[model samples]
Target: MEVLGTIISVIGLIVHIIQKVNQSSHGDTNTTYYTDTTYAVVHKFTPQEKLDNMNIDSLNICYKTAGISGFSIEKARRTLLNSYVQHDFYIDDVIIRQNCMYIKVMHAIPFNGGNKCYGASFSMNFMTVNDGVAVYGSKKINADEELVFKEIANELIKAVS
Candidate 1:
């Protein structure tokens, strides 16, 4: 009887430890709050066999106003288009607004035998009555390339506000 009890206790302890480890690895259960509004940002790379047979990666930012359900796609598009044009980014397309959302798509082209690359980015900005502005930006890039996504996001935020 005593041996059986010891085995059961050891098993229980092991199960408890495993559960704790799993929870910790998945992040704390505590909630996190951001003073500034949060946005869903995505960066993706796609191989373009037609254009120089190179890869094109796009970075996108989706903005939502506080208390608003859907992302302001049109506002984001306008903001991005204006900024890109002012900065002389390659303007392949204008801001697109549809289905109560704004989308901007741009691409980067490689040159100098793939030694150099250039790209454009687009964003849509939404002005909130009280909370300020929200923006979504997207840009395409070549494979194995790195760009300042965060810096651009910050700049967009500043420009619209």
Candidate 2:
């Protein structure tokens, strides 16, 4: 009778462990999501053959602006939309909001048959007191575009400075 009771207790313990594991495994199944609005602009410089003749580096600039408001989702969204419109960039897509505080900008520039290039991508949190924009290039960028990037950087610097 003692041996039989011990065996029954061991079986009960095993069953309890299995039940706890199963419950934990199935407890949280909801997928987490993130939201961001993407703005993109593409300019074709030359024909495939002409571009093939020249060397190119992909250039990209990403910057963040803050201080418009505290690090709130609503404020971030509003600032992002306003900035996109002010910059005159085309909005490609907007993702649903997640439980985070930040806005991001991504840029991609391709050259020379899209063979070789460099790019930049970054994000800014809403709590930031200053904003920043950057310019990245493979070899070099056009004087005009470079100037524009500088202007953007200056703007960001001013916001932060």
Candidate 3:
């Protein structure tokens, strides 16, 4: 019961290219997702707001680029959103919350199936969305290929805790 399974979409190798659209230039709708500053996690995203056009559009672009079928970003959106809204203790940062969402998607492969492309795109976008966090200048978080699934899950838990 202690070890919930963990899945990772390692970003190093992937086939699909996430159409590199400038998120900030997309107008007001996606601006929230591209904000360079961090925000405090203050509220639960409603079921509706969770799959807001911003995330859906981004995820859709990824899926489309990957040539994936049968997977619904809408469904993935709900599942990832639940990771935050339904959390037990508390996750404090909006950035971490965002990472939590992508990580869950990568790990769970909740869609009909997931690919290296999805994982790469989601994590890359998550990092970019949060001021390019832990992604540059020695602040990057590396994945330990040596870690067991349970250990990885614990690390993820500690990350958002």
Candidate 4:
């Protein structure tokens, strides 16, 4: 399964590269370096979709905002970013992951195996960079009238209730 996963990742990287090269040949400069479709890709960003590259400390800051900790390895964190999460959703390098940040973070970083705190932070960042919105309201407000998180999580909760 690991070998299969690695193969898929390699293939996805190749496809992204080909797409990039084709776009460049047409005089398009939107060349995005993606490692694989196996990794989550950020579809949007603040101040336009172009990311200026924030430090890994930004992840820690986000974690801190959520009152969490215990993800210290800068190299590992940087590897996570560079290996996956491209462009402005990036720390650097090729993009990485599937839909779940939990699985990826849990596996990617060393010295902190199966840590929910680290995983959740990456998940949140993944969600934020991709869709970056949150919703809040009570039963008192009409569902349609309520401000939504601009993503599926908000609606899923409502549907379940």
Q: Pick the candidate with the highest lDDT.
A: 1
lDDT of 1 by residue, 85-139 (tens): 4232233444343332222323232211232244434344444554444444444
Expressed as tens digits, the lDDT of each residue in 1-161 for candidate 3 is: 32332222333223122323433345446335454788889997753454352253343222101222333333434444456432222222222244324332232222222332222212213233322212111111333221222332333333433
TM-score of 4: 0.18
**Pairs in clash, predicted candidate 4:** 38-97, 39-96, 39-97, 40-97, 51-88, 84-95, 84-96, 85-96
Kindly list the per-residue Cα lDDT of model 2 for residues 37-106, writing each as its tens digit: 7866676434343223322223234332334433444544454555544232222322222432222233
Candidate 4 ranges with C-alpha deviation above 4 Å: 29-161
Please report the TM-score between candidate 1 and the true structure.
0.28
- Which pairs, if any, clash in model 3? none
Candidate order by lDDT, decreasing, is 1, 2, 4, 3
Where is the poorest 10-residue window by lDDT in model 1? 47-56
- Name the lDDT value of residue 53 in candidate 3: 20
The candidates, ranked best first by TM-score, are 1, 2, 3, 4
Give the worst 10-residue stretch by lDDT in candidate 4: 99-108
Q: Is candidate 2 or candidate 4 better by TM-score?
A: 2
lDDT of 4 by residue, 136-156 (tens): 211213342212212222322
* Reference-based lDDT, each prediction: 0.43, 0.39, 0.31, 0.32
